[model samples]
Target: MEIYNNHKRLYIAALLLFLALTLYAALIPAYKAQNDNAPLPNSKPLSEQEALGKAVFVKEGCVACHTQQVRNVEMDKFWGERPSVASDYARNKRPDIWRNTANLMGSERTGPDLTNIGKRQPGKEWHLIHLFQPRSVVAQSIMPAYPWLFEIKERAAAADVTVQVPEEYRKNIKGDIVATEDALNLVAYLQSLKQVSLPDGRPVPKFLYPKQSTPDLKGMGTQTEDAGLDGASLYAANCQACHQQNGEGLPGAFPALKGSSIVTDADPKALITVIMKGYNGRVKEGFAEMPPIGVNNNLKPEEITAIINHERTSWGNNASKVTVDEVKAVLAEIGK
Candidate 1:
């Protein structure tokens, strides 16, 4: 009994010592990051609505699944920001939740990484729609709906709430009730999850607006055969039937074309290549991307070119067109 007691005492003492060291190490830097950088976000502070949404995030125990800090490795490999430092956590926090505490880690990426998830594709309405009913916009999304966030109103109350969709994006909000202020706040909080740049220990700009320049295509894809076709039209004809006209792409398969920055970026080459040669990525980011649909026996190079130009230019964008020549060049480069 005495021997066992001695062993138990030693084990407890060692465990306590280890915990004390880990906490001291982790908390110091965390505290410093928060205190140092504090509330001086490149963007504005949280609004009343956003604050409320944050509370919802907490009450929902989102922490159990996700982490705010972007660990260095995660930031580099997965494109997440480095781990949340003390300065990052410190600030004009009202509740000071975990002010002096340090406990942040991930159980699994059961849900997509929330780090910098806000403004993921701009257009606040998209977030509201997705939150209200993810499967409506994302065929394979695993995230649960937060319909409680909305009030379910009849008829569009605000111009902002009524998003422009294809005549075919038929699955409208089930109930007429629209989203409420709290729902808006949650959306706002979500939009606030932006990529923060801390250059030389001084944080850089974090904005809801895209930091990079967007293109502006005016008269590009007006080909004789493909003339007058908008992005929606092209998407429906060439891409949508497979990717879904609404951009809800098949799960574990084809990806959504709508709201894809790749489709919107100024670089028409990538857009052209993706459309022409098709793409392949691990199932993790949305499944191994499918083979190029345009390169198949069904579509022609000119049609692919017209479709790419339309998608990029029609989505409230100003991108240059992918000339048939450019599409040709891509095919040649791919040895197709």
Candidate 2:
């Protein structure tokens, strides 16, 4: 009886060991196959600056909290997409970052999924502020403050805004460079996000971004409020070539106007000024500056207002419109 029991125990252990080896052998290739693609779902062409930021991201241990991969489950919930392919990161990348398997899949979602976060907000200013003071915009954000990332410096009161460097943080009168140049690299990287819906036949509109909408016509369309219609139309004609029909702007180059406090919720005076004066100076990533459109004296005021109204209402934001008189004031302020 004792001999028979020992033999039975040995047989059971051997069977279990065999099954475990089979499972491991099966999963090993599957893991290699997925990781073989490296940096999955990241399709954008990365510039040198973006690549620098990516290195920082890896070094900063941000990968532990935030993930770049979008799983089938996660991709569908956030913005409907699919499992990533290895080829997405092949260009401008080495050692392929296809990380959907180990660090990303098993990690906790402490921070938001970074798969499409690059352009979620668009402007560098917004990122600067959030980094400067997290609670300022997102009340409950747990992300660490990165004030060291900004450079604070004194800037001259130039009607030409080029004097606004450490341009990432402070606007208007500059103080000191708040964040380091490295910060801007990360901002550039984050602003690179784009939606995958474009792969299909569906075109996305700026107004259709899935954010809570807010609108109030109670005190809108005054003479000062309606100033940018023609400017808007002009922008639609000339600027849309790069900024795109959607307000989000281009992934890496054009900064967005949708949620730009400068455009949507800031002083109406600034909005008129930018349209009539046509802004220069880099707002986001590129060293390339915006050419002035305010040079068109022949344009009508009401038309500019219509454009501003469309933009304010187009993005999921609600605000009063700029009027003709307001445009004139901004025009006068800029001496145009």
**Count of backbone clashes, every candidate in sequence:** 27, 40
- Over 212-256, each residue of candidate 2 has an lDDT whose tens digit, in order, gives 323434566545544323545555664453454667654444577
List model 1 lDDT by residue over 148-206, tens digit each: 76664456655524322232332564535466676677777777765555656765323
TM-score of 1: 0.48
RMSD per prediction, one decimal?
Answer: 13.3, 12.5
lDDT of each: 0.56, 0.55
Give the winner by TM-score: 1
TM-score against truth, every candidate: 0.48, 0.42
lDDT at position 180, candidate 1: 67
